[model samples]
Target: MKTSAADTPPRKRVIVLIAAGLSVLLLAGIGVYGLIQGPRTGPPPDNSEADGPAATAAPEDGTQTPGRIVPVERSSDPETFARNVATAVFAWDTGAGFMPLDYTAVVMEVADPTGTEQAGLANDLAAYLPVREAWVDLRQYATTQHLEITDAFVPEAWATAQAQAQPGQITEGTTAITIEGVRYRAGVWNEKPVASEHEVAFTVFVICEPAYDTCHLLRLSELDNPLR
Candidate 1:
């Protein structure tokens, strides 16, 4: 007695099921990441027992010090900053073939120069670079086959990012650090090229660092908005 063709199970059946399952999971994860805005900021107050007379000492430049937050104001030329940002933008690959770990930044040109505050160059750079960087890698994990594409951020990239984003968020962590009537804010990020040029962009915010630079993404967002 020997086994025949009818005795064998279909190999394609299992493969087909796995492929379909992967597709569903990938789509679901993307939806969750984008749609779910997570928790929200609420309420205010509690400055009564906040202790002693607050010091009005400023950094002489503009940024507020002696607090959890600080406004970034160490930016020179937007064009040059963009170049430095490019190094950081592509520091970490997005796993997609379009942007792999071995990606490089090729500056085509810079557009829309936003200042260091409230939706300017600095803000946009921070938002787009850092967050997008981690997001890109993390996204690929839940992408399809759970293939962990060699995710690693390079040094030059990180340094370049720091230089470009740091100046934006003077106050690393606070909301609306008393400033002019510009309603200015700052954040830092590690953004990637916006699909085409691959130039680093920043996001602007109204507050300095969200959490003492713990949340340095406001810069990236600010860099993206507001006419510098």
Candidate 2:
């Protein structure tokens, strides 16, 4: 059988048509699956630094609970309180389905138990919530943050108040308490093939009213790039 040039379809055109059909089917399948499964809060791959050594060790049996913010303990000591807050704030996992708003609430509780102060803290949370959610949507939720508190000191005014305090005496609110430390942040976007790491020194301030047993975060300023 003899075929004319116009009678046979071009091989390249046929291949292109098949490829287009397959691509469309794949896209449809993805959409359908997304609708059926809903959002996934799964964490990143185990190879992530999250699987590495934590500030605290796991049980001797080598068992550990991953995902979700680890419970932070409250302490009367300003230094202890600040360290706990820093650890929790940096150690977040969107992959574990941690909502930004909820995480912010937990931070608020630790920094401002009385809820009557710390306007700066509130403002900062408001700004961060949206940015974090957007980053999570971009598949940039996998991250590791570590904090080490180098020193915590009471300011001059606060120190003076402590010195003047009599036995069983109630003192006015402390002017400020400062905590100095270093923080490490690492992030990976496997999809984008992007990785980032940074270490910086940070300072945080808290105000306390010992009489009411209340403390509120005032500021978290002063971040210096260690690499610089």
Candidate 3:
């Protein structure tokens, strides 16, 4: 039977509390991604000719060009599933006629089946994706972003957290995978193509196997902060 948050066991509650605290820290501006919050006044005025033609406008039908970002095929393999979730979390286009919530929905589609973690997972995504205001600001530059994963592993901290859990406190197949990657962003600035890249790391908590035939996302670590 599904249990309410108030009915969650003590150890499980501790884990959730820890994740919540991290979310608070992220919102407080600690380690916030600068690209999203940086100068929003649009590209500089002087580089018009050097930058190339202005980016093509979004389709009038309100559809993404190239293609919409979507998650990889579902997998029973924990590592594969974690990578899929990581990709879905980081891939987005501000000019794609989709809001941050649209991208958030992609990940939430595979969230905890019991619904226990969906709310927390939504909070987790908020830390990774720009808010609606920031999204609009980025759209002006026609910005799009994706991640190139460099490494993924079960971090030692996850093992430690597991060790502290009381029997049955954590779901049967739950695990945490830390993903390290380079975030790449591209857009038109002054009518010219411009791009930037930054290294990022985060932990994805998931459950797979006996818990379900395919893995499901549970929560995310603070951006640039991964279990190690």
Candidate whose TM-score is highest:
3
Off by over 4 Å in 1: 1-78, 95-126, 129-223
Ordered by TM-score, highest first, the candidates read 3, 2, 1
Q: How many residue pairs collide in each prediction?
A: 54, 0, 1
Candidate 3 clashes between residue pairs 3 or more apart in a chain or in different chains: 51-192
Compose the digit string of candidate 1's lDDT tens values, residues 1-228. 111334322212111222334344344332211112211122112111112121111112443222221122222333224223333333332223333212212211222111222233232233333233433433333121111112112223222222333232222222211111111111111232111111122212222112221212122222212111
Instruction: Estimate the lDDT of model 1.
Output: 0.24
Which prediction has the highest lDDT against the true structure?
Answer: 3
- Report the lDDT tens digits of candidate 2 across residue range 1-228: 112334322222111222344344344332122112221233322223433332122123433344556666666566666666666655555444556666777777656443433454655544333344343443233554556667665544334433444432322332333445555545443323333444433334454434225444544532331101
In candidate 2, stretches whose alpha carbon ends up further than 4 angstroms from where it belongs are 1-67, 111-114, 126-130, 155-175, 187-197, 207-209, 214-219, 222-228
Q: What is the C-alpha RMSD of each candidate to the true structure, in Å?
A: 24.5, 27.0, 7.6
**How should the candidates be ordered by lDDT, best one leading?**
3, 2, 1
Show the lowest summed lDDT stretch of 10 residues, model 2: 30-39
| Model 2 TM-score (2 dp) | 0.49
Clash pairs for candidate 2: none
**Model 3 per-residue lDDT tens digits across residues 144-194:** 788999999998766665565556656667888889999877787765787
State residue 100's C-alpha deviation in candidate 2, in Å. 2.3
